[model samples]
Target chain A: MELDLSVEIAGLKLKNPVMNASGTYDPLRYESLVDPNLLGAVVLKSLTLNPREGNPPPRIVEVACGIVNSIGIQNEGVEEFIKVKVPLLRKFKEATFIASVAGLTPNEFAEVVEALEGVDIFKAYEINTSCPNLEKGGVNCALDERCIQQVTKAVRGKTNKPVIVKLAPDVTDIVAIAKVAVDAGADALTIANTYRALVVDLKSRKPILHNVTGGLSGPAIKPITLRLVYEVVKALDVPVIASGGITSANDALEYLLVGAKAVQIGTMNFVRHDIMIKIIEGIKKFMVDEGIKDIKEFIGTLRT
Target chain B: MKLVECSVTHNLRVRPEYHILGLECGELGSIEPGQFITVSVDSVEMVLRRPFSIYRVFENRGVIEIFFKVVGKGTKALSELKEGMAVSVLGPLGKGFPLYEGVTAVLLSRGVGLASLALLGDKLKGLKSRVVTIASFKGRDADLASDNEYVKSFSDEVIVLYDEDRSSDVENVRYLLNKVKPDVVYTCGSKRLVRLLKELPYEAYVAWEERMGCAVGACRSCAVRTVAGYKLTCYDGPVFNVRDLIL
Candidate 1:
């Protein structure tokens, strides 16, 4: 029996449901280690209007089953991405390229999309409204329903390309926020970015990261994000892209069963560069064992 | 850089807190002087791989040496390994120090920062360049140079400094710098020492340290603030020119 791993999110067609979360996987860095073409899509690091220097040292720390990071979306900005990164990414023809954009204001978000208007390499745009590590404009936008709608609408007006609004898990009612994004014309929803967290060094009696606070990712956040994904997907009409603590095919399958159209791998990429291959193979093997011919049969098939 | 499982030849505790691990890895092709390896400890509790500088590489013998302090859970777990144990290693990763043959060089290493530059001293010696090493430790008990004979053979002169005697330490380093007036200087230490070394007149290269993820630069967790922009310590460098870095 042949298993179909293909998934269609928004308008772009993905070979599988597995993709990378922004800022976690750099294709340029891992291109030689793992074939980017093997993954369903590659989400580039979040970019701003201008190049950012990011936060100071001690940017990451490992806790029990998770890692806290305050990288602050350090990127070469949008213009540099178009000139340098886009050309490099264009070589990977098999993978759908989703450019992740971050901005301080709605107008800035539109400007970034305007700059990327006719570039054929990019299949869609991931408007990052929920990065907890940034000093401003990231988590703020996702928390307020008005700001989420404003950014989504602004980016939607700029490009005909599908827009996926990434939401923060820090909100009180993530379902309400998801509805706002869908109403504002978001083609899809990336349910839950890292949760805001802080780790204190016992000996030093101070924070581990220089920035004092960061976003937590990995197995620790999986259950929390899983619940959020289930709630948001149930409440909204737009496709939901689950991204939090997805390390294995079983983890990805859980999200798919709970109504996620696709899943993004983040922290686990650090454990092994070739992890995606293992996940893809695992997913195929699982479908065969379960006698499932198509992935959609299991997607959103969780028993209530 | 490729991932390979190497057998541990020796795991010696040179000091009470520090251990020097020796692995028999065959032909780890072309590891630069300042490059590092990320070591995986096969324990469920330890999820992140620990990054260690290549303290020494005996090419002919196919042995790679790493010096580490049992500071936390990861390193403490690594310290328990015995001979013949297979340890997963991802290596020759990150940018290394640039070697300029026939030029005078000063190597300043503080505490465990010595692990990064110990091999560079040997490389400079091979280049027929004048090399002076300043090894500083928190106290006499913390010094591991006595156990490792490689440090003595690598540099022309090795000066030991103690933090307990701090009043004359900076002056002594300055005195040596004035005497050598080398063409270039390289340092690896705490932020204070790096900041102090930055004030020196000559061109200097500093090996930076940070809490890293995906020591291969895939994860943007190990970023160093530079004058130009944020540079990945794992990719752009663990070794960066002092002038380019803001701190």
Candidate 2:
């Protein structure tokens, strides 16, 4: 029997539910390595209103089953992104592009969306309020109910396109934040970004990252993020996009079964460039073997 | 560029900590000097693939060599592998040293920094350019200089400096810079060395080493702050002109 991998989130049709996590996978860098068309979408690295230089050296370090990074949202400004990067991305006509925006204020968030409104290439806007590495407008905004509502409402007013609010996992009550985000007009939710973390160098007796702290991602955080997804999906009405330490199709399946409409591959893109292709194949194989006709049948099917 | 499954033909421990890993990759494509490969460690415990500079490439023999120090678990696991074992490698990554033809070139490196420049000296020599290679090491590990014969195979002259020898210090680098007055300078080493080279007026390119999440540009983890802005060492460079870089 033929299996269907197609999914729709906030009206955007995805070939499958596998997409690259924002800032983890750059389609431009891996154009030669893997076909972008194989996955559902490609999320560009987070862009801010102005060009950012990012943090200094020692930006990442590997732990037991994951990695921590203090990249600090390094990117060319939104104007350059619209003028230069968008045209380059247009060549990948078969792949869906999701523009991830990071801002220091509500006005800045709306400004980025307004600039991207004319670019037909971007199918969705992922407001990255949950990034823990930035000095300003990162997880701090995601922590406050007022900030979440303000950013969501501001971006909602600017673009008719789908707005997906990416939340951080460090909060005391994720459901409270999700309620405010949905109420403020978030079309969908990227259920949790990297967890805030620190790693001390045993030899130096100092922090490993130049920024001293960064966000953690990889298989180590999967169980924690999976539990968050399960909790948020059950409490919220909108579709949830799960991201954190997803390396394989089995990882994606766990999120799907727990109610994630899509799964974003992070940290693992560093392990292997062809991971997305392997994941897509694995998902298809799982579906066929299980006698499933539609992938939607598996969404939120976890039994208590 | 491509992920190829290579078999380890040789893994020789030249020094107590350093090993030269040779992989037999079939029809290995064009790999320029200063380019590197990210080797996937066999252990599930080490999640990140270790990046190593191309020490040597025997294109005709379908073999490539990497020089690495077993500083951590990833390289330690890599050193444990025997011959005929399959290893996944992604290469020839990052922007390599630019080809300087018909010009006098001076190469300066320290410790394992030589691993990145070993093939570069060969490439410069092939271009018929006058090449002078200077390597610096700690006092006791001066024996490492003699172990890498390839360093001398291609350079017109090779100088080894020891930290214990006061005469052959940073001041000597300045003396050599003035003495050579070469058209181009290529360097790879500690940040301290790079900072010293940054003050020089020559056209210099330095291969930077950073803790990388993705050896590709995606994660932006290997970022180096430059006058222009931040650039990924994994993407914009493992090599960059000294003028553009802040330090």
Candidate 3:
């Protein structure tokens, strides 16, 4: 018998436990690679109030194990995304649309949420606290509880839609900052954004990335993301969306077993575009083989 | 997007010291100028595909020709390619340069930066552009790997410039600008020549080269900072208006 794949998080039931991560697979560009209709949901790149061209070149620096990127949230802003990207993305087959957003100020965050209102394609918002909080000392908003509460409250006040706070992994106590967001009325949380890192060229005697710093992702960060997911699950009663270094079906399964209601695929999709579909199908097969009828049955149920 | 193999029948060097490695891929079968191919050069050292512009494609003895220079790690790896060893390739990407259909007096290159104009010379010849192919040398004994035979085959009018030292390149550049006085100027690899031509009163397109991280416009690595904005050299152009770029 086929297994029931629906999994609920933040009052919405995902058709499956997997969603393409923000900033990884863009449906507008790779439409030919996959049937967007097959995806559970597609989280878009981080949007801001103003369009950003992103960082200068030498943006990518290859490391020993993986890669680092200083893309600086290059996006077409919320206005263009609604005008151009939404109508195209709405064509996806039963896929929920999650808008990932970044802003320098709390007001900036609210402005985009308010702008996106009435767009049926937008189901929820992921407040990217990982973005360099320009108002602060270039320290990410996720690093400070006060910044988290301010941005969360501003966004929550504007729209009744569920908000998922995407926290940066560069913080000292992520749980405290998460609790601050939860207290300020965020519906759920996505544990960990890309970790801050760097690489250098031996010949040039200079940093590899032009920006000198970038976010590191891939197989190297899986354990850290998983640990964060476990801690967030233990701390908060609300749902947790786990992301970072999820490259396989088992990786998704592990996130679910640890406590993530949904898993977002990031850099792995660039290397293998079909990894999302493979993971989704694999989850169903595991459920069938285990005689499990639904995805919730596996959430946080690690065999002791 | 046909992928064909080209063998290195001959590797010659010309004045201004540029490596002209020729591959007998096949009868490029109606190849145009400005088109490029992604060539794979693999070993224990590096593992990635390097894209090279089809410098010159010719049909002789039923074999196609693809030419390139030793510019980067990929090119270095390609240069080390044995005369008989086969290399994998993906080809003829993007639109090629427009061969002037009318009798247009285009300023041909006369220095080391002449690679950009090499293919254009052949294309212009086909369309029969006044074909003023002017080439020059850096200095005496500066003939990198001067092969007299290969030089005679390409140029319609080769202008050899003799400079004493470092400053002669600038004076030679001014002389060519005045002598050619052509309607349009096209350049390939030299930033110095492109910058020089930018001041001249002529429509020019400087062929740009940047390290392409992902060629399919995904990474946006090979972007040239133009006056308008950052345009992808791979997608938007491997060519741009001389005035549009900062050089």
Candidate 4:
């Protein structure tokens, strides 16, 4: 039986249920080793209103089962990204391109969407209101209901394409923020971003990263993020894309079984560049072993 | 960039503090001096692959080497690997040192940094350039085995400095560099080296080292401060012009 790995996210049909998390994989680097078209989707690094230099040296530190990183959303400005990246992105005709948008203010968020609206390359806009490493500090959009709604509404007003609002995982109540985004205009939700965490270098007697704290992602946070996806999926009717500590297809399967429409591979890409392909292959083998014909049938089939 | 599994030929303790991990693989095509490779540890605890400069790439022998200090569990685990074992490797990563032929070049290195420059010696021999290597060590134990052999193969002159004599200090290094008056300089190992090279007026290059999540530029884990702005050490360079870097 041929496995139908097709899955939907806010009306877009993806060939597979697997896609890369924002800012993790750059296709240009390993052009020969891997192909982006093999992925269901590709989310580019978060783009701000202007080009950012990102954080200082030592942007990442490895921990037990995970890594803490504060890249400070380093990127070419939206204008430059469209100019330089759009043509390159067009190479992946099969994979859907998602523009991960980040800005300091809601106005900045709206302007980014407005600028990218005319660009024919991007299939969707991922409003990244969830980054914890910004100067404003933790959970800026998570706690502030008005800020979430405002950013979502502003972005929603500008583009006809689907808007995925990635929520910060450091919040006290993530469901509440998801509600606000959904109510305002988010077509779907990327359940959570990396959890806010810190690590100190014992030899140096100081924080490992210059930002002092960063978002943590890896297999370590999988269970915690799984629960987050579970709660959000139970409450919300909209599509939920999971992005956290997913290392293997089994981890991805857990999120899919818990009702996530698709999965995003992040830090694990560092361990092996072909991890996404390994995962997609893993998922295929799993479906064949489990006698599952279509992925949508297996998705959200949790016994609980 | 390619991922290939190579058999471990040897993991010899080349020095008291350093071990040279030698792997036999067929043709890792056209590797430059400062270009590096990342080795997968295959342990759950150490999730990320550890990066090492291509200390030596011998196409005739089908072997590539990495000289590393066993500071943490990852290196410790790698040091324990026996010969004939298979290991996954991603290679010819990052930028290497400048490859201009027939130019007089001086390699200024400190501590384990010489490992990054070890390959350049062989490359320069082919280029027929006058190469001078001035290496400084804190003590006798920190010195590498190759330092003894560099003169016969690549360098015209080999000067070894030690921290105990204070001869390895900045002022002495400055004097040595001025005396050689080479066409270009290449360096690695410590920030103090970069600080010294930063002030010098001559043309110089640095093979920087940073903790990287991905050997590819995508992860942006290895950001090096540059005069132009911040650049990803994994992508933009592990090799950069001395003038280009802010540090």
Best by TM-score: 4
Error of 3 at A129 (Å): 1.5
Candidate 2 chain A, poorest ten consecutive residues by summed lDDT: A130-139
- Superposed model 3: Cα runs more than 4 Å off: A1-6, A90-95, A202-204, A272-301, B1-174, B177-190, B207-223
Better of 3 and 4 by DockQ: 4
Model 3 vs truth, CA RMSD? 5.8
What is the lDDT for B169 in model 1?
74
How high is each candidate's TM-score?
0.93, 0.95, 0.74, 0.96
Model 4, residue pairs in steric clash: none
**Predicted complexes: DockQ each:** 0.59, 0.75, 0.14, 0.77
lDDT of model 1 at position A222: 93
- What's the best-to-worst order under lDDT? 2, 4, 1, 3
Candidate 1 residues lying further than 4 Å off, grouped into runs, are: A131-139, A202-205, B42-45, B165-168
Q: Whose lDDT is greatest here? A: 2
lDDT string for model 2 (A26-89, tens) is 8888887878877899988888889887888788989898888887778888999888888888
lDDT by residue for model 3 (A27-94), tens? 75555555666777778888899998877776664453345877767777899988987887767747
lDDT for each candidate structure: 0.85, 0.86, 0.71, 0.86
Which residue pairs in model 1 clash with each other? none
Question: Cα lDDT for residue A22, model 4?
Answer: 88
Any idea what lDDT model 1 has? 0.85
Off by over 4 Å in 2: A131-139, B140-142
Candidate that beats the other on lDDT, 2 or 3, i.e. the better one:
2
